[model samples]
Target chain A: MNDIYLDNNATTKCDPLVVEAMLPFFTEQFGNPSSLHSFGNKVGLALKNARKSVQKLIGAEHDSEIIFTSCGSESDSTAIMSALKAQPNRTEIITTVVEHPAVLNLCEYLETEGYTIHKLKVDGKGNLDMDEYKSLLSDNVAIVSVMWANNETGTIFPVEEMAELADEAGVVFHTDAVQAVGKLPIDLENSAIHMLSISGHKLHAPKGVGVLYLKRGVRFRPLLRGGHQERGRRAGTENVASIVGLGVAAELALQNMEHENTVVKAMRDRLQEGILAAVPNAFVTGNPDNRLPNTANIAFEYIEGEAILLLMNKMGIAASSGSACTSGSLEPSHVMKAMGIPYTAAHGTVRFSLSRYNTMEEVERVIEAVPPIVAKLRKLSPYWGESGPVENPEQAFAPVYA
Target chain B: MWDYSETVKEHFYNPKNAGAIEEANAVGDVGSISCGDALRLTLKVEPETEIILDAGFQTFGCGSAIASSSALTEMVKGKTLDEALKISNQDIADFLDGLPPEKMHCSVMGREALQAAVANYRGEEWVDDHEEGALVCKCFAIDEVMIRDTIRENNLSSVQDVTNYTKAGGGCSSCHEGIENILMEEMQARGETFMPGAIQKKKAKPAAQPLVTLETPEPAAAPAAGGMSAFQRYKKIEEVIEKVRPNLQADRGDCELLDIDGKNIYVSLVGACSGCQMAAMTVGGIQQKMIEALGEFVKIIPVDKAQYAAQLAQKQATASA
Candidate 1:
């Protein structure tokens, strides 16, 4: 059986060209960039060129602004903590309730340490409340951190405008753009975003490499303080090969940016439209217009997501879910919960995130495979009846054991 | 991915008795969609011998849950109600060559549904005895009696084991303290003196205090050493901050207690601490010390100079009003 992978948001397959660019760094060109030798000069020059490539991909004004880290979480942690360290008198953090766990969990931890956290709410369509977000921006706020796009629902946030507002307030702003980096068009030179984070793995680069872009003149405190690296903004010996791979991936992403918006998006829409038409009572979860081009989150009501995923797995079709059972948590995804999605729909949400490598045939194969799985699982569900699904899905399936 | 047993996979793929019996005499349904799993079990019993003539189940859950329900129907058929009642969650698991530890709750769900079916057969309400006890794990709606009973029956040793067996402390884990309390109580009943932390030791001290009433006031007086009046907790909180002061001072920082309102410990960081990024760590250290010296009820509020001044002025206004 052929594997049809649609879980690209989880991680993308490393491009072979990126692998070819990185192979020489492992054994042949293996030299520490900080070493004062001819070998070091070659590696150091490669690092500089790679930085420029990444800088161009995101439209950053200068290459020096990009600080490479191990992963997206590290970049997120460094950015948020740096803002707090830069302005210690400010004990408040403004963020969204639907942010990835990297930002949400850290903010929660800070809350326990006496920092007041204002988690802005989201509407049913997964759009942030700008009025509430503006109201929370006070002089005491150290930073306003929000994700450029939601990982689960793929809903793009209005970070450009939000960042400008924060800039006007003289407050630091950071965005975890891990999902948005290669999927959307970002012009950091034109935006007021003080910092942005990107994971290499999200854009066909190898894992264990990330980039934190801090605008020059933005006061930053290093999370990892040691011998000067990332121009003293970050520390540790650079991941040479992975960084090279990330650079090549970034360049490739920039080259294929239009294809992603055109061909890849068409495939995503076809799969989404096909699933919705074939599967009854199914609907898309996020905003139809303001979403990532290569992503779609669709909810198949009444049945649980894990069952659907297992049936899909049997057919060698890969996907992901926001269901509580899928995560082994009592509640579904925080993004779904923040949007106030009904439990019936929330428990059955499936996310199909595509990449540049995915073909129309693969999307068609998944569309053909998913409807039957949903229909089969819905048949097994007690809440689903012969006439139709029960009204008030929550109370209709109340616990009979207790 | 789950490493399900071959038996489990077979039963899941080809579930036996996968639908409801139309003329079923007794029906027992358990769990819910919100709980991430649910089962509807129907049984047809022979009126003369009281033997289970047929069993059918409709399950809405994961692979393990469906397999467990399928395995359950196969295990209960052709057995008397008394014999079916003797079938533990372990038996259902054993029939399927055992389930993953984390999926043990699926088997437990099957067992509970069976018990409910038997109760329905006997014309009795499936009144769960465990529900009467105080609720402990709010995330899973698990109660104290359920935690205690599962701990004793399964020989559960830690919170993780309790979670695997009953899913109690499996969610947000705010009820870990309550679960630990029940664990300690059960362990003490078994003549096991070992406890998890100093909080249990503190709890054990109160139980041993009735023997020496005169000595009780002396030890209690130490916690409230400065005075036994309204400001005693405040003075103690200040003392705890004094302990953490040197660590902060080493980093060119310092902390001062601004005010104490109820359990809230209002404090302000000064000098390098005022703009230090590690201020969260410094405040956390002070909060930990306060919890150790005072109690868990202390809520530390780190304020800046302006916020501290506003709070002080507000306190004065409220006092006058």
Candidate 2:
């Protein structure tokens, strides 16, 4: 049996159809899309069709609004940079605490460049503080880049409503929908969002391809300045094959949205319930009410995450951890820490992010395997059955930060 | 994934003498949940000889930490408390072949647990005594003495090296400047020139968010190493690599040093060697000769051409930014 991979939030295997669609671009149709030759015209036409496919997936009005880039990081950086450059008078940037490194690192760099970066806090359940988000939106705010859905917990933020608020404030809003693009329904035609980021690999497309949905008439600047590719909005040679692959993957994502919402979500819930039911001191980390269908971030208290992952690896189960030991930076995930997850469980958080590829059989295998693994690791832990871990996990962190 | 050695995996999977010893006379505990790893080591000590009759441990940490604790328990049996105290963090790692540099803190936790247990047996108050110097790294509970000792012992050049060895500057990194001063102090004491801007230059990627809070800050179970300083080894490696370079340069190839971990020598092939079909063979030949000339078992890990280029580009971007 192959390893039961539940780390789709990291990256997904490319759909065979997507790979097949990409192959022609690498060989016969390999031409610079920007060139004025017949070879270039054919490639350019293919790129336009791919952009249209992406446009339909995101429910955008025009295909011209879609700008293909290398990956999600570049798309996010470009969108934020464009917004900031378009409005130099507004030096303030508002973002969330639990953003992926793509957004957070860029904001950090911007902060060093004398930008006032207001990183808004989240609730104990990993929900954004709406009141704070409302209060922070003001005339001086240059751009507000909030992720549509968190990569870790899959907690889908209310970006639509946030975008409405930003629009009312006359601010340029960008949602990093890298995790949400294909999974959730997005209608940029009706929404007030100026820009959104999407990564191909997050949804059965190959890596090294991404899309930035720029709302029409939004002032922008190119992140990479070279060739007039991506309609002069983005520079450099287009990644022809991956861009074609991304288009097909985007279409497949739309088709598989139903299965993702039902079957995959069912498996995720089963895995979450199965682990929480069997393992003592285990609890779900984020808000379960409005979360993505695929992610189940459960914190198994009293034991560390890396040990559990190692044991699970032996059983052909692949998952990720939020433990400080697992992260090379020697800190538990900033998301979990931000949610104020207790120290005992914080060090032992396991993230099982599912995909349409996962099955109930694989889910069962995980359920059957995880409990014993946690039990074994807990035996070695001094905190287990001791006064170390709090009985009520929610009460772990007493003083809630404002 | 952490490239844990076979011995570490064995010790971690089938831990020895886990759990509290009821008849144990002395007990030592270090680290806390906040720090992500902790150990409570119990020892049955003979009063007359101060020898450990039996040793057991209950560790709350990652694989390497548990394995280190298990290995520590196995190693301390029938050995005097003083003798066990002499067993440094590096010694535990040596027993387990060698742990990944990231997991070195696990071995350090083991050594500290031993010290705490021994101090407990000798009727000494060590838990408080361990916090002797001014606190340098608040997030990791790393004191000035601990940072200085680690820098002096390891001959650490930069804050990153300090982090790898003692986990002093791994956290929020607000104390990197504090660690930098210690590194500067220790390096100058040895008459070695230290790059003062090394720590300050490698800025933290992003500051911690408003939501994330350090609720509990734990102690520094992290200890220093015992060996020929990294500076001395770096010079020896440079001299050794220079010996092997002429042969490679003759073939229109060259290697650039990336990093020098204890047994792991990271280098990137440049010139003709970058995409040569016989690059691995060349690397192997160089490794064999360098080991003989340097009189040390060093694995020369060649960073792939693509990765080397990406790293160089990122470094340039950072410098230019």
Candidate 3:
């Protein structure tokens, strides 16, 4: 375990209670839900209960609305692929550039197969361009898949409004709510979103399990086809243990949503403010007023993000970076590039995502450790002089990339 | 998360020469904030002997970049300007116990900084730009010459290898075809061929001839500091051989370095490489690396392992007499 972990957006620690709930399913109660025997019937009853737990957590009208998949990526792929397969005539997709690669990469692949993919741009604050988004919507579009909260910046898109607009255009809407499922209050029963995706691991459940909340009346097609599991909506024998763990995690998420918005959010805000106060040429990198309560992306100009992350790791702090080096590319993130963030700050962005388990003490330790590391790196920066931080990186070093 | 070596980690934590020298006579800076890594290398050269007295570095990059810069500064100190110019990016990686392939570009950055610093001391012009129509990977702004040089230096066989060393085709991947053409061109020039999905399939024309018209030949008068000089060209063969040594060793194969005479290099492929069919590819790769290293092409003269051993014994006897 790290002394301080601020990478909840990547993955969270599995809750012990959720692990305990999964243990029985893995050991003694390992019968297949498909069998007609008493052992199978008992497991089927547990499966139904887990589905109901997920339904209550997301405020779905029926337990059957939640279809279990392997992970968030699988859920996202199913949602987007099902929408396009359900309607063959609509050969276009409308999405945002700031979407997680699960959606963006799929859309790009679909483009090669003759589907017109319109990727909406984002502003400097990581907010989607609403006018372009509105203009791109049409009956020709099969689906509009945008992330509810960006995994990198935590900037929440107006997915609800977009979903309603897509609905009016006679299109299915899917939002990759992998980051927003537990942190925010979601009422899928009363929402216009045709489908929503969730990952169990993001909310302190075991990995390899996810929920695809398909509205009761929405037309659907399964991405996987093997067994009659999930009412022929999804396939393969269920990941029974992980599904049980996910159910407990969902219940816990419902219980902790209030604490997440207040306590965890306060710690995140303090860590953001403290780092900014001590470091120069640094600023938050999202729609600060309307983002996830737990995520804060801070960019410090001139110095690169990977260096900062390594130094912080040395100090027993775990975090993440938006730099290209982290992603095994020669350029920064697609989200940072799409936002047109200045070159100086874009490559230097660091993301800190908090969980309800984090505390003010860990936040304070991070605040104290960051300032000195930044100063030390600045002193070693070629672009940084004794005076002020580098204002324009492009001027000092030519030939930059997006 | 990056599988960095202990030496790299030590250098990152306690970088030997981490700051700038106020009155340094020679200074060379490469990369920019926009490029995601930058380095400013300062050197104090002893004027009459042209020997480096001291060195310092300020690097803005990842941990490996910092470690590479630190290793470069240490390696160059006390060496003459001529000797310093011979240090390849591979030498920097070797000094720090080798870097991951993905982080190999950091060592390349260090080599560029050293060249700039040496050129600065000699009052020669150094460049950061490519000529018009020379850019290959536009997203990273890496040009054709740099890509070719890196492919040769690292024995890179694919677009992914090129990106790992020089970051040329690691962008939007539009230039992947351009890089593949270059790879094919370089491979054919050395007579090495593979048949991975028609990648190494021979064309009807002279195989050595470039298949694509997109690549512009390296300019006759290459940029002073940015381009390879005679020393760098001469050193490249040894570096190329050294770079492939471990891979050969891994398979219980090896090569004995004997002599270099103009366009012909004499070597005895030993161990598993002695009479193996795949050694043909290794020989082709060595020649290909040299062809790109120096603008002119070279060939390898395969001396049998037994014959070379006899020749070495005869030479030793003659020296004693």
Best by DockQ: 1
Distance from true position, residue B132, model 2, in Å? 12
User: Which pairs clash (backbone N, Cα, C closer than 3 Å) in model 2?
Assistant: none
lDDT of each: 0.84, 0.83, 0.83
DockQ of all predictions against the true structure, Cα-based: 0.27, 0.22, 0.25
lDDT of 2 at A210: 92
Scanning candidate 3 chain B in windows of ten residues, the lowest lDDT window is: B217-226
If candidate 2 were superposed on the true structure by all CA atoms, what would the RMSD be? 14.6
TM-score of chain A of each: 0.98, 0.95, 0.97
Candidate 1 residue runs with Cα over 4 Å from true position: A390-396, B129-321
Model 2, span B111-164: residue lDDT tens: 888887887888987753454566676545577888888877877888767875
Model 1 chain B weakest 10-residue run by lDDT: B203-212
**Candidate 1 lDDT (Cα, 0 to 1):** 0.84
Q: In candidate 3, what are the lDDT values of residues A311-360, reduced to their tens digit? A: 99989999999887786666788888888887667888999999988989
Model 2 alpha-carbon drift over 4 Å, by segment: A386-402, B127-321
Model 2 chain A weakest lDDT span, ten residues long: A393-402
Q: At residue B260, what lDDT does model 2 achieve?
A: 61
lDDT of 1 by residue, B1-321 (tens): 777899998988778888788889878888756657888889999988889999998777888888999999999999999999999776787788777655767888899999998889899989654454666765455778878889899867677578756757865667776677677778888878546654434521222223344653432243432224546666677788887677677646788888776556788898666644345655765675677675444677789878779877997799799
